[model samples]
Target chain A: MRARIVDKNDILKIVDILRKDHEVIAPFQGRGRDSFFDVVTDANRDQVKMHLHNPYYPPKRYVLPHIEKLFDIDQAKMDVKAAYVEPKRAIFGIRSCDVHGIYHLDRFYLGRDYKDPYYERLRRGLFLVNVVCTDKELDIDNGCFCMCANTGPASTEHFDLQLMDLGDVYMAVAGSPKGEALFADPIFKRGDDSHVQRRRSILNEVRKHFKLAVNWYSAAVRYITTGQVPEELWAQVGNRCLECGACTYLCPACTCFTVADRKVDGKVVERVRLWDSCALSGFTRMAGGHNPRRAVHDRRNRRFFRKLAHYFVQRELSMACVGCGRCIDVCHGDIGMPSVVEIIRRGCAGKENDSTIIKR
Target chain B: MTQPSSNDKNIYLPKVAILDRVQDEIQEVKTFFWHFENPADQEEFKKFRPGQFAQVSIFSQGEFPASLPPSPTEKETFFTVRTVGSVTSGLHQLKAGDKFAVRGPYGNGFPMEQYYGRNLVFVAGGIGLIPLRSCIIYALANRDRYKKIQVFYGSRSPRELMYTQNLREWEKIEGFEFYTTVDRGDADWKGNVGVVGSLFKKPDVKVPVENTTAFVCGPPIMFRFVIKDLKDMGFHDRDIVSTLERYMKCGVGKCGHCCIGMAYVCTDGPVFTYEQIKKLGEDI
Candidate 1:
């Protein structure tokens, strides 16, 4: 069927419509230069920006919360009940790369026998309304290596309404039944041939402008098997390692967590699940007081291996790096994956260059 | 107990258990024996071996590692817990029909069959003796299957000694030497007065290196000194097996809690050699 069109200015109005039935979340620029998705309400109209680069953290945080209470137990009765929460949310302005990340999480959480009810709850509620990244500075500074990673400057799955901006008006293609139903409302109108052609050209332009080229498969392979390479190289790379877990936090595909049992009133309380990074020192501690990977550098190496070498290689999917580059900006040490990949390439070429060579 | 085996994943479920018995071993330590009221699990406890442990879950309080002081050979079921933290102290108040949850029979236990013919050296300090107590009693029961048996136990003071009555019963057995020591002796005490490591000073109990299997457990400081002494006394790292304590939230290897690099203490071992610990690059 023919798609519908809506003016760029009226995007917030659509959000107002969805808020009646769901909690509408949109991109709101937070402190510094970073953008994060915040729930859309009338109070933050000026704060919500529909057209911006990817956020400091992916949408995964909302679905898979950093700290979640999984289940609660009653000490007196000895009966246990799951802490189930269902908040209906409409996620507006999701970038294509973030959508791909949510897709991976969908498979990880839903594909397994033990389903994460918390993630599944928000996931089922989330309605995607994706917008095009028209700003080149947003594309470059964002550090999204989408083409090499082969996710997209646009997504084909997961998203409901795909909004491609054509300067004045936006061509809104209804990718799913929900999108079609939403489009059938009074606000949107049926589009002509030229509008659809305009969206095709706009998407093509976004893809043409994508910067930061990478050999994704080679980069992933090298990251896992890069052990034979010298520690001096990793030392040079490791020197920049800030030991911050931002890379895993921002990446759309990174999913490792830890659980803590929080007590209340001397009873077996709730199982609180939090985002855990292997970069932390206590990540591998056993009860009898044994900690493996005690060094900061080894933990740093483990994060890289987990994303590029381990989970991705084993799953035979692209390395979990969505090329979001939140790690680059978040890292105070300036030792993100892009610089690490350059070092890997240099090492693979057998050149004895240091960190200074990669910087230039 | 013998390490968790081919039973399916559900074996690790944390179920509510009632505290049926409690025994105070020392000022800060108490042992609790519990049973599953669900009736079905009363049968499930049949498979665990000596030296295996469970993650005792005290709701809202926290979970801690405690070994099955009762042998798997016993048809009756219970776990012996020592009160060390808030969760454990809370457990001391629990009595018959009071419920708590437990997840395990996790991690590898002492290799009983492999150590059958070897002289067994059990070196324990304070409550470290709890996990080792099962193996000691099991070996004592099957006395004919093993070689020389000896236990070198030490506690902070005479008051801190656990299972004293049981230790006395074990003392009366022939060919079994239960050498008890205290860091400092009280006026009424009339036993060896020194660290358990002092037992090595006596010459007649020298164990041959080739046919000796030693098991050690205690606070990290005690294990540090004791392991060094054993290595110095011609024992290889592999010949000595020690149970490790780490924060293991899930008895299965999936949770990152009990991980030591690639090794999950819940899966690969709670019992390991110095050789395995060396590759981990982690502190013990």
Candidate 2:
């Protein structure tokens, strides 16, 4: 009915207690800087960084995986057989923006005349354990725009259990029945809202430290509806674009993908879904080698419009971006989100200047 | 919030279809009439429209979306293929009683209802005749509803022309004016020997543009030339409808392969009027 605190000394008791009812998956260093979810064993608390923000990929991998087999269709005989797959687990240390990313995906896929059985099955078998932001180690001076998008480290619903960091203990509140059942174990003891409020104030202080801001509420939609925004603008931003799809790869909400057909034993056709980005030159190639968006400038424009414009036409909301800084962090060209916006804005402001000069 | 359903995963699923009949039309082209071994789906397949196509798959040969060749109005169902790829080639090897997989009657078909009071002009090139075959049959089946029916068929050569028997049969139908031509003619050829676009030059061709609908399906180059001819003849862009063919993976909107600019060919159209297409930037 209330909340509890898992203290520094009780970390083992808490993970062991939580693992009783749920398959506890916590973030651990996989290889080098790459992070992955692993079973939370007692000796691995140092490896389990629960206070960290969203990892390399969103927790979406637990739900909508990159490659999943849909039902197999017999080509010779036009007969369809339904395929089903499901896995159950609990995730620890998910950030709020990543949670919202899953939420956006839900609205796009679930509860309709047609349902995504794979995503639905994966969603059904998981619990979300979110950690509120208290550690401000990642420098926010570079204008990360998550705050402007109204998604942040602070909880905005969707988590089953939310952990708020205090000086010596982690305050936990169960947001769902599953969370409630897990917290009812003796490993957790009832705590007060004062700790939550204190943590909340800390998160508020952390939010303001960010330097990035995308002022437009519906940048995706606006960009799409404002079609034909001159080729020069794209060429300007296009020059800076490294043509690498790192932004798409690290995005919490980016879901564009490709389907690859693999032959097993030269008899079976295995369709594998791999992540695809419109930013790539080969994204829309036809059989005889005709690419509609031939130029990188055109692709640059398309990538932005697809997120901000195209999907906006149908979904009303811009599916273009989720204000995640993954694109910023991963861009080798230094022509990531902040620069893209600035070039477009400056071009729109009649700068008549060329974007060819790469800035240091 | 709930996780998004992986409904998209279902699109790759194929359906089994047993081949009932195969008709070799031209040198390269053949028509396969197939039905579901599952009897209930056979009934649903019977209800497919004239222009909508099916994503047909031949075992171990890959899958491609082929136009439904038979008129929905007709009791028989089939698909016409111009054996160009591995899937179609595999399909070519199959005999009656063999089976394959099929998904759809996908894409926006020709607006049959809108053509009710209007004169219907059907323009097709080479194998593009396959999709138009359904519409031609439908218009002929219900010939009394429309004022005029004119079909202009074109091909690269005399031997490449498809539906020779049906083309002759279509001539016998009252109120139907059927004209065809070949870019290159054989010694025995008695018909007009020129590009199919030349057939539109015939003065008998009617263009009551205000109350007329034209269906165009062909190679992209032919489409452009024929459209310019239609526009020159004062046919309004809205009155000119064409079926587009692009690389389509999922017949549903999600797969993203058939996107032409912002338009998804699988969902928004495989059939779009010129009025709709002019705004979409680039060739459909």
Candidate 3:
């Protein structure tokens, strides 16, 4: 990795350099506490906040959009044409946890036997600029548990460039060749060993600020892997779920989607794919009305099993829950990952040797 | 930004297939015989094994997973679809020359070659016989590789029976044993008038339990009752095989609709033994 230093005010110069060849997207503060990632144009480039709360809506939509067109079918000609788009875009000011989310998506979509062309296209064009969460006042949310998930305040890799704020000057570390290429710019200066030391001390100081730190992550993983969690605990968790699918939609690692075909005109039909969730009963329901996971509790159990089970963790080579805590912010009920881990820990406290009953 | 062209090997892209003919099997069920319009795709698809399935796309309706009913030894590729949903209904409206698209021969298919020199029993109820038809025809085509083969099929009534043409042909074969039953018999019907399980109890019919592999496919109730009968007859759980059905969007394993516990039914199996199915911890 190559290191450089830039003046605090010159952080916008980095965005300006990226916007020359890419459509730069950075976070902006919204009404009250709301913040979102939007395209940086000439007019609103100054509004791109350097310090703000991480957006509840993940940046995964950039790679896997909410609704994506798969193909277009010409009915009269009986021809199917694939709808493929790959825009040269850079997601600036992305947090560490969200960067891990994209890595997990990479392991899932491109690391498999059958590669998803749509996901691959968007992913190839992506340039990630991860911003470290060093400011306790603006960056750290009460619900964030990235410390427990071992993803942040600064990720080790997967981002093209990483920027950390250090009061007087910003320390920029290049993680890839694309990032190192920006070091030739006049705004960036050669960094010394002192900048590295400051980054470590600042990260150590900010690590103590997270309010929700889940210590029972490994224990929950063990219980879930061994199928030792009781049915009652899942039922209680499921009862609290409103089934709005907000948790899945906001979570950075959820990749399930359903496909549909719509008539664009009399002669053309478009096949589209939409993000889907396991919480919905209709997700697993067969056409004839036979649903394997008909009960809400069963669906809830699946969500946790897919996240923490050793089989899936081993298959993807990464945990599905990236500890971003977006699920906590979006969930109407208190059944987020940290809360669910606490429930499992308490439920299995004294029942280690007892026969575990998992109802289907 | 330049427009990205489609990849030639895109997994989601379904190859156009032209329908050669259509045969009405039962009241709502029809067998569509089709081949890929491209000779390369048709040649590549001929390697599919028994019990594998394909994702069929009917232009305006949607895509659905349908089992490949034709054996590799058979002269043509076809799907036996019962018009139960909008996708299948769209398929039913297509003429002989009409075109649709198909991808894969996905899922782990039945391991038929492993049952060499063993007696095979196929039990199917109604439309459940669709997937099993591929294996049965494959076994019959390579009869020298196996011993006694028996087929027991039942439907709700006389008109609901599937593959009547194949059923008639199997009855006349020398070594093959074919038996049919219905829940309720019609006025002109003369076959057994009971559940398919009743055929196992016929005095003249003998089911070899010593070295046999039983394939069961049907409604869940019939599956349960048939498993009980097979277990009572001293059949091991591993010796009984079945193909499962689930709502699937991707014939490949990316979509999570067909996942059960730890396994994706699309990739790990749509074909599983009774012992493996029990460990899935989900209902059929």
Candidate 4:
């Protein structure tokens, strides 16, 4: 199928068409500079902003909500019921970085051996409408590093419908059969090669717009995998980290969760999985109070090494980080991934750094 | 990918098991023998191995990753739970006939086949013996296949010692050396009184570093000291094996709580050699 075009006048029509049958969720402005992936409704249809900032939180909540009930237990009856409900949703205007985020999560939750039922249920039959991010404009915050993470500008797959801005009209590309079916609405027309060339030029022009860039990602991978990272560097990074765990929660690819049983009432109970972070000291602590990674530095080091190390990246088949940089905003101690990488890069380059400095 | 235990059931979905019998192991730890109300459930769960664990659940109280303390050779299945957290405390209040949920014999358990021709030395501190119990019993049951099996266990005091009945029985077995000690002695206690490592000082306790595999499990401080002692005794990092514990939400690897570096405690181990642990880059 040919790549199609949707004029500015028809953009809202496409959203309305999708919203008719499925629950449409799109980006909307949240007080001042904050952006959020909110449930878009007819009353707030005009509030949907395609070029708005990428939400501080990744779009993972659509599939893996922050808190989800995995099962319900009846104590008196002695039975377990899996709480899995798959709801059809059309998520619009997701950035390329976040599309990759979903892909990385797919690799984990839908593992070869054991697949998470709740996550699979939530992920089934999902419709994604992604907007290619050409620059830092539509939600690429300052600490962004998607270029190094290799999920930037645009995604060639996963998106049901991928849209690129071309001034008067948006170049729409269909990645799947479901995405091609949307072109049948007659609002889309076959896009010419000029439109493709315009996209290439725009990508070239916007390449320099990222506030952050990771030139030494491979260097960090080598040093981290080979265990060349000095112990003192980890201690330094650890001291700067507050162990708040905001970094992991805000990160688009961090998939760790903690489960607990909550009493809904006297006789009812629900087992829930809540987003958990390894930065917290209690994450690896045992029942009898023995924690292997007790030091703040050890936890800090583990997070980076797990994400960027060659062994894990190869095992996972993709680097866990898409470089969305949500960690930078949520971090209070200024030891987010970008900062940590810079520290490691500096150390690798033989520069002795002393303090944790937060810079945009 | 490791083969799924059940193709039909969700990995996280637990099976209901009734608490049938409870045996007091020590002051803080108790062994609970549980079986599924459905007889068919028992047949499938009988496949659990040594060093693996199950997620024991109490309806409104939550769940815990409790190691399977009963050997595969035993007809019954049980968890030797120590009251260390809220979940275990909730489990403590439950009586026989009260039902709870359990799923899995998770983790890469002690690779028994690899250690077939090697001498097995079991070292544990306090409640750490809970996991090693299954493997120790399995080794004892298959005694002809392996040579020279010894158990070195210690506790804070004589009263804190666990599985006294089994310990005494194992002591009576010919050629089976069972050594016990206490950090401090009691009036009625007449035995070696020192940390678990002190048991090595006994002239009869000979841990051959070559052609031998030593399994260690204990408190963090005890784990460190014991590993150091084993290294000093000329044991290779690969020769010393141990089971690790971590706060786990999902017994499957998806939940990140049990991960240290690249390895997830719920998957790659609860059982790992020192060489593997060192490469894992996470302190243990």
Candidate whose TM-score is highest: 3
Q: Would you give me the overall lDDT of model 1?
A: 0.72
Q: What's the C-alpha lDDT at position A2 in model 1?
A: 39
How are the candidates ranked when ordered by DockQ, highest leading? 3, 4, 2, 1
lDDT of 3 by residue, B238-277 (tens): 9999999999999788888999988889988899999999
Tens-place lDDT per residue, model 2, B76-156, is 778888776566788899999887777777877887877887789888998889899999999888888888888999998
Off by over 4 Å in 2: A1-18, A30-33, A39-46, A72-83, A111-113, A138-143, A166-196, A215-220, A236-244, A266-269, A280-282, A310-318, A350-360, B1-10, B193-195
- Judging by lDDT, tell me the better candidate of 1 and 2: 1
Candidate 1, residue A167: lDDT: 80
How do the residues A169-286 of candidate 3 rate in per-residue lDDT, one tens digit apiece? 9999899999999999999998788888988899889988989875588989998887789889899999999999888888899999999899999999999999999999899998
DockQ-based CAPRI category assigned to the predicted complex of candidate 2: acceptable
lDDT of 1 by residue, A1-360 (tens): 336778877867788888889888889876667677888877896677767767777788778888877677766677666666778887888887777778778765666444555677778878888766666766446466766666677666678887767788877778789888887677687778888788778777776676666644474355345344465665676667666677666667767777777775575567777787776667766443456556676667666655566434455345666666667777777767676666676665644356635776
User: Local error of candidate 2 at A103, Å?
Assistant: 2.2
List TM-score (chain A only) for every prediction.
0.87, 0.82, 0.97, 0.94
Cand. 4 TM to true fold: 0.93
Indicate whether candidate 1 or candidate 3 has the larger DockQ: 3
lDDT rank order: 3, 4, 1, 2
Better of 1 and 4 by lDDT: 4
Each prediction's DockQ against the real complex: 0.21, 0.32, 0.79, 0.69
Considering summed lDDT, which 10 consecutive residues are worst modelled in model 2 chain A? A351-360
